[model samples]
Target: MAAAVAPTDQGPLAGLRIVESTAFIAAPLATMSLAALGAEVIRLDPSEGGLDHQRWPLSQEGASLYWTMLNRGKKSVTLDLRTEEGREAAARLVCEGDGIFVTNLPARGALAPEALLDRRQDVIVVTLDGSPDGATAIDYTVHAACGAAQMAGPAGLDSPVNNAVPFWDVIAGRTLAMGLLAAELERRRTGRGQHVALSLSDIAMETMANVGILPEAELSGEARPRQENWVYGSFGRDFETRCGRRFMLATVTGKQWRALLSATGLGTAMDRIGEAFGAPLDDDAERFRARHAIAALVQDWAGARDLTQIADAFAGTSVCWSPYRDAAQLLAEDARASPRNPMFARQAHPGVPPVLTPRTPLRLSAHPRLAAARAPDLGADTASVLGPLDTAGKEADP
Candidate 1:
């Protein structure tokens, strides 16, 4: 019900509009991604806030940093969708600019996709659910069920290790963004709208299949053993330097393999080991088979040098390697994680101090990148959004 503001003449998605009602990761991330590309996203939450309003990684003032970062560049509108008036207002807004609606929450009454589409045939509705059958689920549960957790962590460990990152949720978010754009394109071409639905569990399962985990399990009749830091089907793992710092090194390509050998001065020794194994190390599978021997020499060479020396040895070479760093170290050391990178800017949110934030990683040759914008305080835009909605629950003319 907000007065329609003309989209800024910047970024690829300039003129696009999206109305979002979502919580936690996937749905919020999808809209935020579009917002970063210049879509005007209006996010609807309950009068107080949504379930993730106080999600952890909070600032000292108890503001949710997670929510702040995820909701960046979005206008916040608080509406008690449990009421008829609130739901009507939401439906009216959804049928406005671009006629797009996205949510992971249950839609009923006036907020239903069918009702919205009935109101405007060309409306695009995107919904994300935990499962096709409506079962309750989350990233950790999906990851465990998909068999990924079993294959993570140290080799020979008895317990399955869940990754700290919610990869499935992240993937689902990007997938939703892609599907939304595809739907928009289809609507533009045919002048018809349809609903786009996805399940978080499906994303995890499909990713496992795409990465060959399912086939490997089916063919081998066994679950994959945990690999720790070792790269699958290649020679890669972690090594410690004399300075007691650890780094991950991987040699997937022949060029990378050769570079590692050159950097470590172990070409002759590796060649001898390859001859002893009756196969050349140039082949990926062969290197994987002889990884223990290969890693031993590399580890010894690395252990004799400091982390700086190791970095110097591999500098400007095709040797793919990176030193392990915690979050603080990453912020302090990596230029890409700091304001030095075009993707990042330091910005303050509603109740949080200025922190390093990011714009869309996508670069458009035609449009200049937009600066990262702060998230609005809760319900900050409610009056602006609802002001134009007349008492009769209809949008008045601007």
Candidate 2:
């Protein structure tokens, strides 16, 4: 049974309702974004809290930090969707509201887009799959198939490097949110809803196409090579300071090159190196072509100065540079307990100590701020939302 509907949200999506039948990062993240934007998202989980609720990084008392992070600011209801009664209830919950249904579930089940659309003609059905035909492809597989895995990592590597971050899943999720919002607007304008289908594979391929690497390969008959920390075809490299701090430096223009040389007191060394190469140091293309030589010269200068001295030298220069910070260092210093980083906030949940959880990154000047509350316990809102619907399902089951 469903729980009583919560108070009406007041963001741009205020009064809008979304039924989320999704698991994992992409689908859930899409609904989470909508919820943060003031849509009342009702998440349908299984009797056992579903696969996502069991993902790792649990608390000492077996609470899922991963689930809480993605499912924030939404209502949760557990149902046995494998049964006819449960499927009917799921349809009822979706049909009764704003008629927005978002799911990554397989396209041929009770919760399929056709099933939901059949149940409510005006419902907006947004479904995401691994592929258009529903072949199983998560972000990692899609990333590999889309050529990103081969493009990442350092130069001269025989093997492809997988990024620690699942880039495609995030992109797909954000795109899905945009689609859902667009569908909502269209429905409002025409009083007609539509089915929106998206695939992680397609999303990755389209992004790569726009990125121009594949087009460049087709035109030049050469695949782009990995450049590691250096920007591809740009003047950039990671250098270590005297105190062993690492910094990634880049200079895109001749002025920035001159600024870098002046900032690091390497102008004379650069002039000598340029003379040796028979190239002018002021030409960005020439400097990039001689990047190895210039990098070596700058490394010597940077390696002799501590990070503090480097900062002082770079204070008035436009030689773009930033120190590399690991997760612990970043969290403990800049992102730790800072209001400027609106994505993170302190929240306490059952069976877990208060910890930092991520919130929606979107901020609205005209709407009430979305609260980053803890996710509900499994099936916690079942009675409130599906209460009357559950009874009706049983009464008609005969």
Candidate 3:
């Protein structure tokens, strides 16, 4: 909006424009993802900021790192939607922008999908709600309701263990982006636009169904017991090295299972245990059934060696394993998390110090990936985006 700066890297989504009224995770993430792919995303907020403006994981200067990261590569505009003038201005912007509108906020009155579509018949409106019934819910609530939380913790634990990450919200964000693209494609083909609606709870439930959780629960009339760190239907779990560093090892394929045995020098021991149990350890089901015995031997082998020795042994092998590390350790040790990875770059945002920011993870063979950009200051693009609105909320003549 600020004079339309020339793009250095035009991604596959170049020229696609999106106007968003959103907050928190899913909607913001969806727009940000589109922005990374070269869409011009104009994000609308209240004058003070939206609900997530002050959300946690703040920088030392009290800037919301979460908000900053999610809204990167987007133009920020502020409007007081509670007023009739503000609502009219917002509706005008949505109708004028490449006919695409996205929001997780309530779409009603002037900004409703019906109203926007009436203004421009080809408008593609994407809306995400907590549930189909319009009940309030977030990632944590959806995860808990979908029975995932109950199956997440230690095997013997009495209570449900909630994951720290908001996986459902993340999934919903990507899903919304996909839906928007699909709608856009349809609009292009038929010259008609439609509304794309999604619910966070539906995303969680459908994912559970897709992963066989719902059917298993229905057929067995029971919930899956907590599995701790073990990979389901395979040989995998955590083990501690001699230096007390922990690593997860998983053998999902026969090659990986054989490699695990070979690397740990436990082939004979595993064979003996299989013979005692009257099952071959090579079979996936058998491996899962005899996981305790297999894990014990692997743990003992790992406990006798340091992490470096374990890494050396597994290097260039089919043994799938990784050393556990915290966030600080990931930044310090892992090359993938650093700027060495093509997906990441050190960039400065408005109020925070320069930090590692990421462009879209998706790689397109046809187009170059756009570089990540910092989020704009609140209302930074309001004048350029909306021009000078009159007292009646109409765009004034230039």
Candidate 4:
């Protein structure tokens, strides 16, 4: 049976239980989505708030705004995973919880799930790291080493650029959620569980989307200098504008390509634009360039209009698209964030009003729980979580 909550919760994922022993974006995002959909997610963060708390965009109470943004929709329990006692305590919670997502993106000082799962056999664990084969140094270091920092751009820039966005982590988070759901379904059927691992490098490589990138040669040969706005894995896609605001334009065929023809007066019906969905981009450079030119013209059309009007224009069509948005812009234009009818609950934490956190996105029709209470202070759950563990420790264990 699903875990109990008020039947009025909004999302279909009501009643599932999840725990997060994560460092950064990927794991947090995965668990947050689950929480949005009505899963009970207990976020076990590091004792000192890990590497991000005091870093940037400070809260009034001085916690990192970045930290607040990613941690919505969950309860927090801070513990020292480096110590044996802490590890044991965490494993106990995982056993009680249905699933856990772990991030070793900063491949250093993370609790190893392989070791933790050795102690708890039935709990599902999803491990996220930066490199495919081994541990990563950190988010930036791993991308630097894997040539992602260089490949993030075009070939002319003098140096590599840190991807300001968590592209790898975002998609990997979705993938981790998928893996966990699949495992959860399997566990329900078989009364058994499995480990799911995702590497940030593998994810970055998978998302490169440029047709001309040669990873094997690029990694071993010259550290390819960075290039801005260049893609490597796919051919017929590029950025643009509809009436004025920026947009992404992706086309699949000469037919869908015709949509672009009508939208932007460039390219021909005779253009060889076969988008065999999984075809290699390097082999399709000519096709990409032909599309890129027309796409750039569409960018001009999009350059003058505001994002809202542009979005209204693309309401119907296979003109596959996206609008670039930062959090501030998102808060302003997104109907979900409207004060009159918000999709998420907004809260300013006890000491820091700058810690404006959004509630989980899941909306259940029947049993609707509001938002979780404010994030906890460090060791806030020590008594609650460790009490049973302490009593059991005094009793017995293998």
Q: Best-fitting candidate, measured by lDDT? A: 1
Evaluation by TM-score, superior candidate among 3 and 4: 3
Question: What overall lDDT goes with each candidate model?
Answer: 0.90, 0.81, 0.89, 0.61
Q: Which candidate tops TM-score?
A: 1
TM-score of each: 0.95, 0.88, 0.94, 0.66
Candidate 4 lDDT, tens digit per residue, 1-398?
A: 65566546445666676766676677777877777666767777676777655667776666776666666656777877667776667777767555454554332222466655565665677877767667653556656665667665555565778867766677777888888898888888987767788776776566553433455556777544443454332234445443444555656555555555565444442243333323322233544554454444556666656666666666675566676677898777666555445444456653457323555554544545555435545546667766776787778866
Error of 3 at 61 (Å): 1.5
Question: What ranges in model 4 sit over 4 Å off?
Answer: 1-6, 10-17, 45-47, 96-118, 132-135, 145-155, 206-345, 350-374, 391-398
Please give, for residues 59-113, the per-residue lDDT of candidate 1 as tens digits. Answer: 9999999899899999999999989888888998888657999999989988899
Model 3 CA deviation exceeding 4 Å by range: 1-8, 388-398
Better of 2 and 3 by TM-score: 3
lDDT of 4: 0.61
Please estimate how well model 3 matches the true structure, expressed as its whole-model Cα lDDT.
Answer: 0.89
lDDT of 2: 0.81
lDDT of 2 by residue, 1-398 (tens): 64434354356777788988888899999988888777888888888778888687898888877787788778888887777777777778888777888888754455678887887778899989898776899988887887878777767777987868778888999999999989888888998888999989999889888989879888999887877776666588999999999999988877788788777778888888889889877776777788898888889888999988988889877889878888777766564445556667778876567777656666554543456667677778889888877677688897
RMSD of 2: 5.2
Span of ten consecutive residues with least summed lDDT in model 4? 273-282
Clashing pairs in 2: 1-382, 1-386, 2-384, 2-385, 2-386, 2-387, 3-384, 3-385, 3-386, 4-384
For candidate 4, give the lDDT of residue 373. 38
Indicate the worst ten consecutive residues by lDDT in candidate 3: 388-397
Task: Work out how many backbone clashes candidate 2 has.
Answer: 10
